[model samples]
Target: MGLRQDLRRGIRLVKDVMRNRKAQGKLAEALAAQPPLEPHHYRVGVYFADGKVNLYQMRQWYKPLAELSKRHPVLVLSRASGAALAMLRESPLPVAYVRRVVDLERVIHEQDLHVVFYVNQNAKNFQMMRYGRRWHVFINHGESDKMYMTTNQFKAYDYALIAGDAARARLEKVLWDYDFDKRAIPIGRPQADHYSGTLPYTPDERTVVLYAPTWEGDRGAAAYGSIASHGVALVTALLATGRHRVVYRPHPRSGVVDHEYGVANRAIIDAIAAVNAADPGARHVYDDGPELGWQLSAADVAIVDISAMVYDRLAAGKPLLITRPANPAAVIDTSGYLGACEWLNAAPDPATGADAGASMLARVSEVAEDPEARARLGYWVERYFGDTTPGATTARFHDAIDHLMAEWERFAALHADDEEVDDHDEEGEADEDELG
Candidate 1:
């Protein structure tokens, strides 16, 4: 069995290498066609080191970054060729493909970037963080109560642009001796202001249910995925009910770690396809698209696992159900939103021989119509992302950037006469290995 697995891994590695080379070539051609970026043009830089698989992290920031560029020009510094290629094609902001450490340094020298934003905790982020004279701020991909939200890595950045009160409170509990006032800035959820994407299906009387589950986690403590547990049953039940429209948007990395989880994800997609084939009017969607806003805004009820989708949907100030993790080892932080949010259990009813789907239908109906649950959702929304009023979050986000830029000018004046120090000596040799 070990030898067979090794062979499969070897084959996958070869395919990945070939694919990456092709992407690199395409990226080079695309870059050649566009005129080079003017020197010292961009003041804000977003550092994304992950490959194409994690582009969702960068995608969510596109609209917000584009809007910010109006005041302070924004540029995306992409480390992976695939991610750079995708950004060049679709991103609203300019993209610089700095696949090598030296290439990244060139951008630093050419551009007067005062604020660099990081979307995830990718290890390669440290490569860029080593540079001084600029602020390295952690503006995470999404807001959630997961352990990732309060990681010690938050200390590594100069500052963190958090969601709101709940985020600040979440950090204060886990991080020790951290200066929240100086380091953490509550900008609310700026992405909420620009929920892009058009509806795929026409609106109807059918109640739309968005089931956006996270990936099967790498470890036991993070095993919060419901695809293998609550997903199939609930999705089946919803599809069977002619009155419900199911929008299945599984995590992009779903089943990357587990075979069973992958199988269940495929099953849900197949179910949606079969249902749509039989009834064209049902419009049961198998959503693997890049856009996220339409599903959140259009859905009457959203069922999500213990991931960022919880807060993403919550920001909509809409009714949603959280799927209870079937894994006993999975850690649950009830200190914040999860503690009070409504939960959907994965257990099957033995007495009635009913699956979780039937129970999910009832829960969905209750959450959709319950005045009390709606009231609770309103409170949590304000707590996590204050002032859902259109443009409120966006204004706050720009204000934060303006504040940082002003601070940069203040410090730049203080160190104006100091000898310029080069920090690239520590970067050593750049890794030649490319991600597919």
Candidate 2:
């Protein structure tokens, strides 16, 4: 959902270059910081994303990544707009924007960067493995915290930062476990700031259900079914039943055209109007409004697919259902979507009609109405989102990151090519307005 594959704007590439230029301008900030690699002073180029599987998890994980890397002379490889960057500006790592991939390669030559770490996923990343000038490291973001969708170069990565023990070892499976000295560096995700916060719905207990799906049509992979329409139908039926209030939030990347679902199916306004015509009480929720706390706190039940919201919902220890069966290909995506993590729960198909849904709603309703179901979902939630003691978990994560920044700093002392960088950035300058 982060970067729409077919979107016309090469916005990200341009944003990345601008970040680099901004970093180049702040050389003074590094006066007290250690120098870079050799006569070239090769600085490690670190890039992060709004690229996590879900925007929520991306924000969830990146917050700490930024917090821990504050003292280093790291440059950010971002294509995020200034406004967009501001949201993430909390990051201490310097940013270096690149307008285009070809230009980015030219800038890499100019800046003499020796290493690149992407918290974001990229197809071009595989190129870094074949390259001789730099090294590439990958850190994928997710709720289950497993290493499911790693690239082909995963084993070649100098390091792979993960979140949970299960999350980290998933990577070790591919790269040789126990070879941490050479294969992987299990510095868990710094993005997880807190699983604690105010609840979205405490006193007000209307039956609430969250509907979130993923964006997949760019390559035509999303056209397999009519989940959007089916989802709309389900909402209408729920409203008619007058039994629950629905919070319908389509995937942000749903802007892509679907001949089957149609553009109208993608619009929440229509879905909202449809609900109002029916129950007249449903409310719309979003990233800005619900936040993670509210969504986890408010909902009586959550309905989702491979989207990371399931992870958040589980954190609430509330009733949950995986929405599937709308797309004809639902069975396949549900079975293998991204692998291990997706396997965490059961996905009920909405297309099985009201009978199937009623069955699920019954199960979720039990979880909502009965303490036993609530406790069971709670156990599953902990298995998914809960971790060790908060204090110790936070301490281990923060210290590990602080140590990373310090290690990065130590590496800078041995590098020497400053003038070489100025020459390299010339081609990498960004062209678009950056996201704050």
Candidate 3:
């Protein structure tokens, strides 16, 4: 029996390798076909080690990196293989894969990298941290009020590119010894400026409601996801109205932590599909695409979980509802928009019992038409994001980059003396050797 199990495992491993061989071949081809990278080719490098599983965390950086490339040569640096490598291939920005520490050092030197940005706090990041000259900036994937946003690990980076004052305040509260004033830079949300994407449905008189729920988090405090408790209830209520256009965009990691939550999410999606099929002209959407701006901008009202999606929609100054986490222990930061934003709480856990959607319909209807809720959005938008004028956020983002570049130059200049001294000592040693 043991021998048979071993044989089966070995066979499965072989089959897996064979299945991935084509993707591996494609990656090799792409790498070989890459144009010769000259010394000082890229100024900025976004280091992401999360791979394909957490690709969503890296996707938000695409548009911002694309725009930054226009001003300074920007490239994505990855050491991920297989699925991660395959996903990197599809990225809009140029990518360089370095597996070994020595290879990473070579790229850093050859590219004359001025700044390195990190999206997540992967332990592998410490490998890149060895390079002391370049500025390591922590530009997290999304902005949210979750405990993950204000982690102690934040102090690891030389600098952190935050969304706005709210982020700065969060860090200030948590990081006791760190210098918040000098290190934390408020660039606002750059992704918002590049909010250009195709909308599947045309503008109409129907109320377009975007229901974007985050995944059921791994821990209890982070378990703020509303898909199981509120998603079906809210979505069904809206669809039943017959005057609403529902757009369901569940987190990619939905059901990953909890299978039951995933089942609930799928049920809501299937319900939306059924609604669309019944009324062909309803144009209900199931957005599983990389594009986020279209949904945030197109929706008349957004029903989102207590996550970054809430803030992103807040930036649009739309009538948005934050689903109160069903978990009583969910941690919520009251320092920012979350404190003032309107909330919709579903009772009796929509996942259990009959006529679940009925109870939440009235609340959804009331919040959807609340003029007061719409009015309060502007004040919070400006407070959280600061100045929603046409290009204000983008300009602030560029300004932050410019400040960092100038600072890097000064830092390099100050450190150049030490480098020169080392060079002189080596030269003197060579002269002594020649004399001997």
Q: Which candidate is the best by TM-score?
A: 1
Q: Among these predicted structures, which one has the highest lDDT?
A: 1
Q: Write the per-residue lDDT of candidate 3 for residues 77-196, one digit (tens) a residue.
A: 776555346555567788877655555666776787788999989887887776777799999888888888989998899999888877888778888889888888888788788666
TM-score-best of 1 and 2: 1
Error of 2 at 277 (Å): 7.8
Q: Better model by TM-score, 1 or 3? A: 1
TM-score of every candidate: 0.97, 0.62, 0.87
Off by over 4 Å in 1: 1-4, 350-353, 426-429
How accurate locally is residue 395 in candidate 3, as Cα lDDT from 0 to 100?
A: 85
Candidate 1 TM-score versus the reference: 0.97
Runs in model 3 with CA error above 4 Å?
1-22, 82-89, 348-356, 420-436
lDDT digits (tens) for residues 300-414 of candidate 1:
9999999998998899888989999999999999988889999998776676676677867787898999989988888899999989899999999999999999999999999
**Candidate 1 — which pairs collide?**
none
Tens digits of per-residue lDDT, candidate 2, 1-436, equal: 4356444246646765666467444433442253442333435565543331224433454444454445323455544343223333444444444434444565466565555666545444453344443456565545442123433455656666554444444444455444555445444323333554554323444677665555545533333223453455555445555557666655555544453344545454565666566643444333333234455555667666555555556555566666543435442322222332212122345656445335454555655566665666644433433453344445665554455555555666656353333333333344332322
